[model samples]
Target chain A: MNLEGLRVMGIDPGLTRCGLSVVQAGRGRAVLPVAVGVVRTPSGDDLALRLLRLSRAVGEWMDEYRPDVVAVERVFERGNVSTVMHTAHAVGVLILAAAERGVPVHMYTPSEVKKAVSGNGRADKKQMTAMITRILGLSEPPKPADAADALALAVCHCWRAPMLFRQRAGLIDGRVSAAKRRTPSPDNHDRSFPS
Target chain B: MNLEGLRVMGIDPGLTRCGLSVVQAGRGRAVLPVAVGVVRTPSGDDLALRLLRLSRAVGEWMDEYRPDVVAVERVFERGNVSTVMHTAHAVGVLILAAAERGVPVHMYTPSEVKKAVSGNGRADKKQMTAMITRILGLSEPPKPADAADALALAVCHCWRAPMLFRQRAGLIDGRVSAAKRRTPSPDNHDRSFPS
Candidate 1:
């Protein structure tokens, strides 16, 4: 699978501030950042209105950028139930916007994203930001932690999507692919998917 | 402030099975059931696909019924974190669908629905189901719990929406309105605005 010229939008879903990043990547070439921004919704508004704002913003981004694929941060176990619910709600809107535009959606867990960008599953926020800055050749890490996480997610997808397609196509054995061989030996995002 | 003849679609958001019910209500008539059904999404499918299915279904219902307003059951604090997340995600999709069509969306809590329908804030499922069957003049309660809950939510909105409008219009004072005077003196759904 030649993944070159593939455009992907990575979304870190949050009700207050959702991070969105677009990256272009393929094999044997440096990934490039196309766009990075955050969609902010006022916490004082009604819940439905807050979600509607997110949905519209995501839809606008998809229409303007027209990415081939969308990668969203998978919501995982968290201490704040309200935060988890809000994140999941935002994620659904993101996925719906992409799906409505006939784009494929993939979810990557935080651990997988951290490991892919920083080579450590338990990497802290600062470590993840530093790695994303270096990976994208940016002068500095993106603003508001969420933006950096979104870029990391986009990069992770670019690095991992090809192997997933190959696995699905039965072109490679279930053990490992050439791309995995070149990358760090850590837990992969596409592995044990649909979490 | 005349909320009569308002058609409303009530939604009970769930990933596996989303219950949607439509009801017609006016100032001086019995609240009538317009439609009742459930939209089921296989748990085996991708999360995005499931939500897209739900989004499409809700969109279709909005187009066919053209409800003036949409009422969604607000997801509340629950022991099961995953369930709460899924419910909130589904609720987001429901609200987005309605909002896209220029429909007003409102949220009602479970206790409010129970009190509005059964005059008991802590009404059990069976008791609520019995009340719904009696109120809707149906032979029996709608099957699959979710469907019945959806109908209950719709009825709850029909009874509560009028007072909300009156309050917003300043036609009613701070004291409980005449409509609420007839019902239980428990907490009202619209009193707090949003949970």
Candidate 2:
């Protein structure tokens, strides 16, 4: 299928709830929900394993849905440094999920998604929900509707520039194998994914 | 729970078959299987996400079973660097699972576990399995016996002291936390765990 019609998985990573939504990517905005839910990690597990589990949970979604694109929430203004660190760790879990699949990911800020859906950069959850319901032609809002917001983000991203996301992430199959070969591995921190 | 009375989750980390076993701690030896099996990460997902999925799979195991401790296979070989790296990564996922639950971990080298299980330090898989059967008083061997071996390693680590292992790693938890705080996040790495 072409970029405009590919499957998209939208995600909103959070501490208590990691929101997730999968939607069909047809041109007529015929979005269908493939899956939606949250993965819960108890307070007892370490942060690392929790993040790992979060990523894995999403991977299971990928396996079942086989989405061609992943659109995730960009870093919002975390209230505390500690919270930011936690959110960043969660973001890591997310990026790893898509990066490993060799699937192209398009990141959208909460503001951008808000603007796209509600025509305001600072749309409230209610507004976003209302707009999402209106746009998707649904009676009730999506389940765990926060997850639906993530799906909306993914749909928005694909709508923004489907082909551009793929090209930047280098998902063209060995298009940058040589470049990836030079990407450092092991205890080193520097990474060289094709952008 | 006291270390001696707690149930332990033993992990044998690998790319494809991550051996999972559970053992109970007691005066003499009372390790038993709580749950044992493989949770496959379907292909086409990202590598990091696979690790995340591994963590989640093992996390589910821990949640369902509530093991008090986790025992992991330590890295000692040098020839297979890439495999070792991935093994370390995979182990990280499992370890993170244990950590999220605040479950203490006891890591042992393959040889050390082998030595503890068999009288010989360099015992092979068959020898290790035999010892495991004898110790557990089982007529038939555990199914998918890698799980059995993992339990044996956990049993050994729990029973044995680690004066030497401590001398080498020097308070693994404290050092790791300090190092993470000091170092900048790796560019491409998604730190799956939070401090």
Candidate 3:
């Protein structure tokens, strides 16, 4: 897969404030920032309404940026259960927006993103902000940690895209060979792809 | 609010299998079943794809059944963290679908559903199924524990609608009067409703 000119949208999902960033891969290891912002929803709103607002915001970003791939921060079970659940909800809507537009999506854990951006799995917010500011050549650090996290997620995916693509390709090839052994028909090859 | 002929759709959100059921509130405490089924997505599919499929399935149900309100089982952070996160994802998309169609969404805990259906907060699956079968006057119990749970959720919402409506109305009235006291402008009345 060609990585040149590839655009990626990264999302840090949260019900109250979802962070979104769009980054384009330039020549070599250079990455250009396209957009970075947060989608805020009032906590007083109903859950359904809040989710709907979040979905529309993400959908608008997908339409405006037309990113080739979307990267989302994988939520974990730690911290407050209610907060985690809300974050998971935001993730669902964000991912669905990408799928609806037929854009490929990739998810990375917090540790993976931290390691990719700062070379440390346990890097704190300040370190992450500093690294991202230096990497992006921005005059000021990204404000509201969520925005910085989104940028980090996009950078992480841009760096890992080649490896992930190769891994998927390898899996597809293995599945195709296994299918050929079971049946000598071309139709069986389609089974390799998830429906 | 008139309870007669009110339609309610209950969703038991899950990634692999999402159960959906539609029930109409009849005279008094009688409730009639309109539809019952489960939407199944293969685990092999990507999370985004699965979520998109779930969202579509629920959206189709909402269009076909035209439910006045949607009731979803409130997911808790228990058991496997991954499973809970998936369930929360399902819940988010499901709620967004309802909100997109302007249908109000309500959530109930597992215990609330059980108590409403079987008068026992700790009612087991068998008891809940039996109670639902009897209450709906169905020839047979709804198959798949998810379907039965969906039906119970719908029935629970139907029974609780009157109280819930009253509570919401009271809250709105109180907010409106409080807003009037703060600023006697009529335009501020809109603030009482969630934007």
Predicted model with the maximum TM-score: 3
Residue A12 accuracy (lDDT) in model 1:
91
TM-score of 2: 0.46
Q: How would the candidate models be sorted by DockQ, starting from the highest?
A: 3, 1, 2
Tens digit per residue, CA lDDT, model 3, B75-171: 9988988888889988989989999999999999999888777778898999889989988989999999999999999998988787666556757
Model 1, A9-43: lDDT tens digits are 99999999999999998444458899999999998
Cα lDDT of model 1 by residue, B44-155, tens digit: 8877788899999989999999999898888765758766677777877888898788899888899999888877889999999988887778987789899999998998
Could you give candidate 3's per-residue lDDT for residues A51-156 as a string of tens digits?
A: 9999998999999999999999999988988888899888888989999999998999999898777777898999889988977779899989899999999988
Residue pairs with colliding backbones in model 3 are none
**Between candidates 2 and 3, which one is better according to DockQ?**
3
How close is chain B to the truth by TM-score, in each candidate?
A: 0.85, 0.73, 0.86
Say which candidate scores most in DockQ. Answer: 3
Task: Compose the digit string of candidate 2's lDDT tens values, residues A34-151.
Answer: 6667767666765556766786788888888888878887764436644544554566556556766777766778887776656677878887877666656677887676677786
lDDT of 2 by residue, B53-156 (tens): 78678888899888777777765334554455455556655665676677877777777777666656788777777777766667867667667767776667
Better of 1 and 3 by TM-score: 3
Task: Give the 10-residue window scoring lowest on summed lDDT in candidate 1 chain A.
Answer: A186-195
For each predicted model, how many residue pairs clash, with residues at least 3 apart or on different chains?
0, 15, 0
Query: Is model 1 an incorrect, acceptable, medium or high docking prediction?
Result: medium
- TM-score for each prediction? 0.85, 0.46, 0.87
